[model samples]
Target: MTTYFTKDHEYLRVEGDTATVGITDYAQSQLGDVVFVELPAVGQSFKQGAEAAVVESVKAASDVYAPVSGEVVAVNDKLPDNPATINEDPEGAGWFMKIRLADKGELDKLMDEAAYKAMVG
Candidate 1:
């Protein structure tokens, strides 16, 4: 799987034509304790850079943008009841949704691990 990141701090773990979407650990840390997450419904389509989800924490409520155009295939149902999972494992189980990619080429616009690290640092 190849992982890509947006300047907004979203990450996409791509495998085949699908990608798992979530906030990076860096993002979660900045958000403080997560209080709520509003995810898009499955089958919902989003254009690249469009708001696909909402994440609210003790500090602020932030919009999670779609890194590339795609349709939501699934969402993490466990978040509403246990938002702390985002603080504990932001990139793993804390993932917000899965998307079926519309154009693989769109990923080329995002940052790789090295570039993202330097940017955030």
Candidate 2:
């Protein structure tokens, strides 16, 4: 799997033609304790960098942007019931959705881990 990141702090783990998407560790830390998650519907389409979901924390609400254009295939329903899962496992069980890549070329526009870290800093 290859992981791509966005300036907005979202991460995308691509495997084959599908990509699993979620917020990064830095994002969860900045948001403090997550309290709610408004996930995009399965089958919804979005452009690269589009705000596809919303995350609400005890401190504030933030947008979860799409790292690459794609159609949402699935969502993590567990988040709405217990949003803190994001903080517990930002890159694992907390993944928000899976999307079918609309254009593989868009992946080139995203950052690698090191670049994303620098962007976050």
Candidate 3:
């Protein structure tokens, strides 16, 4: 599995044709404690770079974008009740959604772990 990241601080773990997406650990730290999460509805379609979900924290509201174009197949409903889950595990249990890639080529636009690290640093 290869994990791709975006400049906006989103992370994507691709496994076969599906990808799990979420905000990065750095993002949660910068946002402070998350308070509410607006998840995309299942079946919703988004283009790469399109804003799909909204994460509201004690500090600010951040848009979670689509790192690759796809249809939202599932969401972490646990977030609505306990948004802090993101801060606790931004890359694991904190995953926001699963998307069925609209076009595999879209993944090319995202950054690799190394590039993402440099971007955050």
Candidate 4:
């Protein structure tokens, strides 16, 4: 899988035509103690850079944007009841959703791991 990141701090782990989406560790840390997550429904579509989800924490509510265009194939149902899962594992079980990519070219606009790390730093 190839992982890509947006300047907004979202990550997209691409494997074949599908990608798993989530916030980065830095993003969750900044959000502080996640309390709720609003995820898009399966089959729901979003264009690149569009709001795909919402994450709420003690600090504030934040929008999670799509790194690339796609249709939601799955969402993590465990989040609403246990939002801290994002704090504990942002890139693993904490993933927000899985999407079947709508436009592969959109991936070119995202940052690779090294670029993202440097950009965030």
Judging by lDDT against the true structure, name the best candidate: 1
Best by TM-score: 1
Model 4 Cα lDDT, one tens digit per residue, 1-121: 8999999999999999999999999999899999999999999999888998999998899999888888999999988788999999999989999999998988998899999999978
- In candidate 3 the C-alpha lDDT for residue 77 amounts to 86
State model 3's lDDT.
0.92
Instruction: Tell me the spans in candidate 3 whose CA falls farther than 4 Å from its real position.
Output: none
Residue pairs in collision within model 2: none
Mark the 10 consecutive residues where model 4 has the least summed lDDT: 75-84
| Better by TM-score, candidate 4 or 2 | 4
Q: Is candidate 3 or candidate 4 better by TM-score?
A: 4
The C-alpha RMSD in Å for every predicted model, in order, reads 0.6, 1.0, 0.8, 0.7
**Model 4: runs farther than 4 Å from truth?**
none
lDDT values of the candidates?
0.95, 0.91, 0.92, 0.93
lDDT of 2: 0.91
Give the C-alpha miss distance for residue 9 in model 2, angstroms. 0.4
The TM-score obtained by model 3 is 0.97
Instruction: Report the lDDT tens digits of candidate 1 across residue range 1-121.
Output: 9999999999999999999999999999999999999999999999999999999998889999998999999999998789999999999999999999999999999999999999999
- Return the clash pairs for model 4, or none: none
List model 3 lDDT by residue over 62-85, tens digit each: 888888999999999888898889
| Cα lDDT of model 2 by residue, 89-115, tens digit | 999999999999999999998899999
